[model samples]
Target: MSDARAQAPETEIVDRNLTLEIARITERAAIAAAGWRGKGDEMRADQAAVEAMHDALTRIDFKGKVVIGEMRGSEKLGLDEEVGTGRGPDIDVAVDPLEGVTGCAKDLPDALSVLAFAERGGLLHVPDAYMEKIAIGPGYPEGIVDLDKSPRENIETLAKAKGVPITEIVACVLDRPRHASLLAELREIGVAVKLLPDGDIAAVIHAANSDDTGIDIYMGSGGAPEGVLAAVAMRCIGGQMQGRLILDTAAKREQAERIGIPDLKAKYSAEDMAHGDVLFAATGVTKGSLLNGVKILPRKIVTSSVVMRSWSKTTRWITAEHQR
Candidate 1:
């Protein structure tokens, strides 16, 4: 099929404007983060990106609000103050100023600055708990597998259903101590496993767009903020994703209850979490698995990103040029 015919029709132009603004924010954050690469100061790098984004957001004339954001308390010294409230189009904001802090510190690939915008009360305000997640590229049947199954079993099932070998399926998981057993199981099953230090948003996007990236699935627990951001991108790309909250402690469970997450174990689909119109964008800060790090040239800097909206199933690979 022609790309145009396969693409979802663009319905709302307003989202395009929002996307442009978000792209600008991410671009600026990427530039600001470039200076902190290899400094062994992840917090400083993230703060610089956050400050740049805060400044860029203030310039935009949207009365949007933030439903999910970084923690604000004594722990953060120079974090941006909350500027959004429950007003205007009832929007929700999810941002990761620098998605891959360690990757940026090591100058690895796939260190991205990410953001997701949805209509008010759209994206789920999930707690900071582990989530058993399963995601695939677009046009796959829903409910093909569940997180309860063994990693090998799920891989075999998906391979049989998709009529491909288990070796062809690329699964991404964070390179953490918790993933050691899971990685071994995937290796035993002949599936290619991509271990990333951070930035599951890029991994999720890779799974949601199989035509460009060969990644067929993403299965693991990541940050709650990243789950929401990934859902926004999957919503735009017509992919399937399901996440169930995993709370490890009573304090975290209470925190979830406080945020009104009724069932911590409830399976949340992409739409269930990020409903209504959505605009998602991410620009690379340091090179990792999905994208390259921002490059500085004599005249300008170049960055790559993937932007999408629910109204359009096609994902745009944008290369932005910024003046030095």
Candidate 2:
């Protein structure tokens, strides 16, 4: 692991302050996400998360910008935001408020509020298009698996490389109607499938941190905002992931071009997607997947997050006490 404490002066100053700021924002989001736990309303849960993040960003002492954020007025909720339109460090912000609303509603595990911050033009502002994604834990060769291969083939290949059996490998997919066929296919291959109601960021992080979650792979199309945030975590954890935009229509294609994405089929690696030093923080909203959810008491709320720095390859587990 790189010594995050020993970076150059300029890098150190920016990274340290950014990490602290992200930690605070994520902590607030955790409390907000918890309020919607078991409410059975995903939208309200997500709104609460976004509101907390908005409040936190406004208070931070930085000239930040929202390169990617909750869609809100846009058709999509987490993509399609104008750059430099929101408050805070002239920096880009990517967030998934209440990443797994269904999980929170059902009290499932691994739901979190995920966010990534970078200097302007650092994070990819991918269009609200499907992305063919494949990822693995650290130390695997690049390009080992592409989206074109069969799910079984990819799983077996990854398992072989990791020296694990196919049966032992666990894959995560969004528990959606669109994934019905994909889920059935994995079942036939004897690979264990961990279907999540929401929160691909938690799934991706689980794949990246194999030791903690035992999720060997993450395959499926999820929110573009979550993908960008996962890219930041992958960079810090030395994992490998590739994503290609899946445009459903010409309007979406035009949006891609508007954001300077020349090739829709181009593959984005962790470094390619998160192009510079980044500060990432994710607070658990419910008791599932990666981290535990917030616990509210009479006088205070307890929140947890996994904050990471790409430049330093440092990941910190933070717990904060907030007054009610």
lDDT of 1 by residue, 70-152 (tens): 54322221222334432334456777778887778777768888877776567888776667778887666777867777888
lDDT for each residue of candidate 2 in 1-324, tens digit (9 for 90 to 100): 346556644553274477877888877877887887887887777778787777777676665666677754423334434433344446777877667777877777877887788877789878766677788888788777777788888988898998878889899888889888888989888989988877777778889888888888999888776788889888888888988888889998998999899887788888888987788888887776577788899998888888898767889998777888
Once all C-alphas are superposed, what RMSD does model 2 give against the true structure?
3.0
The true-structure Cα RMSD of candidate 1 reads 3.6
Pull out the clashing pairs in model 1.
90-120, 108-287, 109-287, 109-288, 110-287, 110-288
TM-score of predicted structure 1? 0.89
Error of 2 at 113 (Å): 1.5
TM-score of each: 0.89, 0.90
lDDT (Cα, 0-100) at 111 in candidate 2: 78
Top of the candidates by lDDT: 2
Error of 2 at 30 (Å): 2.1
